[model samples]
Target: MSSFEIYGGKKLKGELTVQGAKNEALQVLCAPLLTAEKVTISNIPDIVDVNKLIDLLQTMGVKIEKVERGTYVFQAKEIDLSYLETEDFKKRAGSLRGSIMIVGPLLARFGKGFIPKPGGDKIGRRRLDTHFDGFALLGAKFNYDAGEHFYSIEAKKLKGTYIHLDEASVTGTANIIMAAVLAEGTTTFYNAACEPYIQQLCKMLNSMGAKISGISSNLLTIEGVKELGGCYHRILPDMIEIGSFIGLAAMTQSEITIKDVSWENLGVIPNTFKRLGIKLERRGDDIFVPAQDSYEIDTFIDGSILTIYDAPWPGFTPDLLSIILVVATQAKGSVLIHQKMFESRLFFTDKLIDMGAQIILCDPHRATVIGLGRQHKLRGIQMTSPDIRAGVSLLIAALSAEGKSVIHNIEQIDRGYQDIDIRLRNIGADIRRIN
Candidate 1:
């Protein structure tokens, strides 16, 4: 476990480049495993989640060569199927949630995929029913060895069919698409997740010769091809990180410019921040957020208090609700932060409430923040990070607080953010990583 020590009340300045999308990178990294040819990927974020996926691939005998800091070439020339049953493989596979994605590619190319129950941040019940259901819909036999506690799917040959997902699962759709692209005939996915990350995965697969249609929509059609060839793919900018930065600038009253933000892809994220009354300027490809002393929340059409909630793609991402809740802490008005996707995500509001912010944790799913109007600065205190998004939210709070703050178990933060402390320091953030 690691910790972050921060001396509070520093208004940061200068610029920070948003890292490549961690979510998209995780999906695209698994695409190459569907082919034996070499695949080149650029703009790869060096985060724990992505690196852990890369390591999983390496353990399965995928050849990966680094082209540069954010570039790599991967070739799945050979894979050890038997290695998947090893204790070493099961232990490592269970460590990362993204490792579940390997199931689709392996089942597509080798007719079988195996994994121990996957692990990730214990935010809520992230069900794999959508994943296995999609695979079963694609003509794969789903099986679980209760004695070994292993889940697997196998098929003599995958044939495409119509699948209406129980939920619009992002990773589940990606896994199904990966499997479908190599199956016979066409596959239709209704109620599909249309997030930018999923769209990027579709495009990367198309470049690799997978025929996918209805991108950026809830309904998708995939024309299965005999095989997919390797191609170069670059990931999109991380929207979660950009949202965190927006909250950072507003919370710390800092003038900061976010570089190479991929403005076209951010959907409703920028506008969501504007609803918090933060001043944001779109400078070409970058977003310049000016320092703010006080900002007020906007009400709904019926004069109700502002409510921020999450939905499927092309909507507000649930990942940023933590940041939004933190930023609203110092705003001039009240707003209800609704995290409908995950049950335990909003539980960390207790820590924010402990730090002198007026917050009411209505339940495991919602919190209402009564803004302090910047009349009083928060006095920092020691706290442990409950999860990745909450960790960054606490960091933002600590940065704007009046005293020192200590955050333990920051490895949760490291899993998604790439060199976050270093990047923040480049823009005048007073934070340090310590053992």
Candidate 2:
């Protein structure tokens, strides 16, 4: 139970190189299980969730060697399937949301996969039906144990078929694609998630001899291969972290440069910030956000209030809505944040209201923020982090507020952002981690 003690009302100015994408790392770390040859990966973020997945893979007998910081080589030769029956395996796999992905590769190569109920941020109801349902459509038999809260799937051989997903779930689409790559026939996935993470996964699989098309579209076609080989893959910079930094700069009036952001993959993130009247420049592959005393929120063309909502990729990401809400607190106008995917994510706004931000929690799914235009500075107060995104959002608010603030449960932030307090300290922020 560590906490962050922050001295607020100071600007942070420095260069931050974004880490590798956390979501992509989770999906692609399981790719090694699809082959026995060595698969090398670089630019891996040193975070809790990713490390947990690596430990789980090592426990399952995947030979993993660290080439250097943020680089690793994994070979899934002679994986121990019997480990899946152990109590240790259950505890490990059940605690990680990313563990659900390994089931697909196991089923594709070994004809069976077993897992306990996976766990992650308690944001809302994230159903596993999409993952298992996609597997069932690919000729796998699915079973659920209500008493033990476990799931198991097995198949003699998978034959590819058409799958129209109920939702364009990112992880569900990644799991299904991993399984379909080794199936017997052509697999057509309709309404699949086409985020950069998914696109990278498909590109990685294609490099490994899997036939996949429609890299950046909802319709994906895959021709099953006999087997996959190994390849070296580099992950993209985390867009969520980049967006968070942009918000941090606007709220605290800091000039910060984020390096090598992979601009093309950012989608609508930059324009979304610009819509809030925050000024940022594109210097090559880097994003430079200038210091600002105040920013204004944009309204719709017909003179309606600006309403920002989350949708599938190419739209605003739900992960950054928390940052947007906090940034709006200091802006010159009002905006509505609609968190459509998760019902409980906006609940953290209560903490912001305590810090003197004018926010109306209209419901579980929406919040309306009226910017103070720096008319009154937010006063720091004690708070606790609810989840990863919300935790960072609170940290941003505390940094821009007046006086001292203590934030407990900083472990939530560490799960996603690596060495966050240390990074802030390097950028002239008065943040200290207390154990």
Candidate 3:
């Protein structure tokens, strides 16, 4: 087991470059299965999830080579689809939510796909029903056995049709889009997810000869093509990492600049940070956060105590709520945090509560935070990371606290953020990784 020991109350002041989008990179790397040519992806984060996916792809007979540290050349010219049924594949596939994404490409290329139950953060019950529903709309039949926990889908030829998703689930939308790209006819998806990650995936697919329109709207129209060609795609900068950096800067009273933020693609992120009374200056494509004496929570228009809620695209993301909640502890005033998407995501606030913050747990999905507003500092303590975002949130809290703090289960953080300790340390954060 590894842990991070942080001597707190040091402001983070330096310029840091953000990594590529983990979510988008995962889909792009897997999208190569749609073609039998060489596909290259750049700006891929060197994180656990990406490494695991690379391992899974290599095991499936796809030729993968690291052209550079963050660049990969994938040649699926000789992919063996039969490996999809192997126990080895199933074991690795079951460890990631992104693994289920390959089902679409595999079904498109081989007319069949088998995937085990996918795993990710155990925040709530994530169902594959929406994914299968998309495939079903594309003329795929799904069979699952309770004991097996595996899904076998078969369709001789996918024929695209109009699909209105029951909900705007990101992965669900991506899965359907992947399946529909090679279908026999036109496919129109309404109420689709239009997050930047989704848009990037669509753009990459389109670059490979797939036709997709309405990139920034909840409605998508795709004209199915018989075959897709291999293409090179660069993953977008990680917005979640940018948001985390903003939160870290605010909490630590740090004056830091985030390089290569892709400011235009960060829809609603700047405004969302503004809601916390955190100010950011734009320097070209970079975000500069000034040293703050204190951060204040903004109230609603009616002058009532406010609440930051998570929703689908065009709304705040649930993943960043953990960082927002931690930053709120040092901000002035009170705010309610409603995590509607994931039930267990906000439960990690118990650790913050133990650190002398004023928080009321409404239930599994809601919490009310009354900030101390820099009048007090959180005392150092030991903690165990429960999940990915929460682990980073704790790290930020520890960085701003008094004395020393120790955090365990850093592997969860490593699964998403690449060299988090080294990067933060470079930015003057007094954190050390102990293995």
Candidate 4:
């Protein structure tokens, strides 16, 4: 258990480059398991989740070697799907949400797969029901035992069929697509998740000889192929990290530039930021954030405050809402923050309140933030991080606060962002990581 001791209230001013997306890198790393040939990946972030995923892949007999700092050569030429039965695999499988991603590729290649209950943040009850439902519709029979939390899937010859997902679950859609890609017939996925991660997965699958159309749309049609081969693909830049940097610059009142931001891939992030009064300067492909004292929140004409809620793709991401909530404390007007995907995400607001943020916890899913609008300077205090996004939210709060603050459970923050303290420190952030 390491913690962060931050002496805040300093403007972090410097140019920082965003790393590769964690969400995209996680799935792409698993894509290598679909083929026996070597696959090269660049721009992979050096983070805890990525490390854990690499470890899991190694357990399944995939050979991974680092070519450079943020690049790697992965060859899944010798895969032992039976490694899923080991205690080490079971432990790692239960701790990472991305472990479930292996089920689809394994089932497609070996005609069977076994996985334990996957884990990540304790935000809410993210049911595997949709994942199982999608697999069932793809001609797989599943058995779940609660005491072991083990899931087993078996299919002799997968036949593609029309599947309308219960909801637009990202991982579920991906699992179904992976299984459907190797089936005998055509598979149509309606109301599928079209997030950048899913799109990247689709691109990787297509490169491997899987016939997939509608890369950016919700409806995906996959023509089953007999096999796939290794192909080179680069992971996308992290949009959540990009959004986090925007929140960081706004909170610190610092001028910063986000380099190499793929503006074309960012669907609704610009509009979402505009609603919170953050403007961007698009110079070619890069984004520049100018220094600002405060921003005004958008409100309705009826004189009632509106809430910014999270939804599926083409909507604001639920992951970045925590950062937005923390940034809103320094904005000009009040707004409601709604996290529809998770139940416990709003609980972290208690720490912000102790640091002098004016927030009303409406319920498990919503909170009303009446911004002091840069008029009140929050004083530093000791706190513990709860999850990944909330941990980053607390870090942002600490950076904006006055005096010194001690943040325990910094490992939570480290899980997603690599060398965050080191990176921020380069930009004049006074943060020290201590164990």
Candidate 5:
């Protein structure tokens, strides 16, 4: 097991570039299978999840070559169907949730796909109903094996139709879109997720000769094409990382600049930080956060305590709620954090409480953070990272604390954030990764 040993109470100052979007890379990496030509993708983060997916693809005989640091060329001219039934495939593909997305392209191109119950963070119940239902709507026969915790979807041919998602699920939207691009008829998806990742996926598909409209809106219409060709796509900046750095600067009283943060795509992330009274300046395509002595939380106009919650697109994402909740611990006013999407995401507040922060856990979904406003410094302690978002939040708290803090199971952090400790160290954070 690896751990991060962080020494706190020092202000950080420097500039750092945000890595490519991890979630988007997960979907885009699976996109090349729609065609027989080579697809080159740039700005892909070398994280555990991405690597796991690449390994799973390699096992299926999908020829992939890393052209450079963050660039890869994928050619799916031939895929080995026999790999799907192997014990190695079962062990490797089942380790990451993104592996499920492969089924969409596999079923689209080969008409047969099987996915084991994929796993990632144990945050909540992430159901695959939307994905399977969309495939069934496209004429795929779907079945589940309870004993093996597996799903089987097969179709001789796919015929697209109207699919209104019960919720705006990102992966589900990407999967269905991949499946429908090569189907027989036009597919109209209402209530689709319009996150930048989804938009990029649609745009990439369009570049590959697929017809898709309503790029930025929740309603998407895709015209089926005969085949998809090779395309080049560069993933966008990690907005979650940008938000994490914003919280890190504020909580550590650091003056940090985040480079090339595609402002057009970060709809509500910046303003959400502004609501917490954290000062940030937009520098061209970058974000400049100055060292803050203290910041005050903004309450509602009716004098209610400030509340931050997650919602669909153009809304505050649940991914950064843990960061915001941790930063709120040192702010001037109290705020309520409502994690509506995942029931167990807010449970990480208990770790912050152990670090001398004032937080009241209302329930599994809600937590009220009473800011200490740097009046009392947090004392460092040993902790384990529960999930990706919560792991970074704990790391930020450790940086703002008084002594040494040790965070174990940093693999969760590595799964999302690439080289987190190294990047933080370059920015003057006293952190080291122990193998």
Candidate 6:
């Protein structure tokens, strides 16, 4: 395992360009499986999770060509369906959470899909019921092997129908849309996830001859097509990374410019930072976060404490709540972070408490942070990264803390952020990766 040895209390400068959306890449990379024609995807992030998915595609015999650093052409012309039955496929697919998405396209084109229990961050119970339930609603017969911990679904032909999702799950909605695109009738999907990533997937499917409406709304209507063709698609910049940079700037008193952030797609992210009294400005499509000694947390209008919680899209993203919670630790006031979607995500706050932050882990789902206002600097210590988001959060904290910090299990951070230590180093951060 590798670790990051960070020399803290350093200011970062220079501009950083955000990478392509990791979540969108996972969804669109699977879209190529629905067609035999060439599907070109641009601005793909060179991150571990995305690369794993690409490797999985290559193993399935998808013709993949690297057009450039962040562009690739994929043609699923001669897929090795029999490979799915191999032990190698099980080990590979079971380790990746994004592998669950490929099942939809396989079922849509080949009438059958099989996946082992998918693995991802142990943040909380991320149930697969939504994905399989949506598949079952589309006329697929679902089966499970409890002893083997495997899931399989098959269907002669899928017929579209109304689906009111139990929750607005992003991946679940993407999977169902992929399945319904080639179904016999129109699928009216209500309470769907309308995040930018989802909208991008729908738009990409539409470009491929699938009829889809409601681009940015909860109600989506997809008319099943006989077959889908290929098209060119460019992914949006990762909002999570952009948000992380913003928090890093505030915590470390760094002036950083994030370039080409796709401003319009960053719903409520900028305003949420502003709510924390962090000064940032929009320069064209870029975000400029100025260096600050201390930022103040905003309270509710009725004089109550500021409570930031996660909800469906257009609200604050749960992914960034870890960053927000970490940023709040050094702010001028107190704020409550409510991680509603995941129960165990806030558990990482214990590490921050060790770093000298005043934090109250109210429960598994909530944390209250009383900012120190820079009166006392956080002293770095040895820590372990729990998940992708939390790893980055702890990295940001270490960068703003005093003395040396060793962060173990940096592989978790690499899963989401590409060359994070290198990027931070380029911006004048004293971070080194030790193998």
User: Please, what is the TM-score per model?
Assistant: 0.99, 0.99, 0.99, 0.98, 0.99, 0.99
Model 4: per-residue Cα lDDT over 99-189, one tens digit each: 8888888888888988899999988888998888888888899999899999999999889899998899988888888888999899999
In model 2, the runs with Cα more than 4 Å from the true position are none
Backbone clashes in model 3 = 0
- After the best TM-score superposition of candidate 3, give how far the Cα of residue 117 lies from its true spot, in angstroms: 0.7
Model 6 C-alpha lDDT per residue in residues 185-291, reported as the tens digit of each score: 98999999999999999999999999999889999998999999999999999999999999999999999999999999999999999999999999999999988
Candidate 3 lDDT, 96-140, residue by residue in tens: 878988888989888998899988777887888888999998999
lDDT of 2 by residue, 367-421 (tens): 9999999998899999999999999999999999999999999999998998888
- On lDDT, the leading prediction is 2
How many clashing residue pairs appear in each of the predictions shown? 0, 0, 0, 0, 0, 0
Q: What is the C-alpha RMSD of each candidate to the true structure, in Å?
A: 0.9, 0.6, 0.9, 1.1, 0.7, 0.7
Question: Model 6, which residues run further than 4 Å from truth?
Answer: none
Error of 1 at 40 (Å): 0.5
Better of 1 and 4 by TM-score: 1
lDDT order of candidates, top first = 2, 6, 5, 1, 3, 4
Per-residue lDDT tens digits for candidate 1, residues 243-352, read 99999999999999999999999999999999999999999999999988789999998989999999998889999999999999999999999899999999888888
TM-score (C-alpha, index-matched) for candidate 1: 0.99
Q: Rate the local accuracy (lDDT) of all candidates.
A: 0.92, 0.96, 0.90, 0.89, 0.93, 0.95
- Candidate 6 TM-score, true structure as reference: 0.99
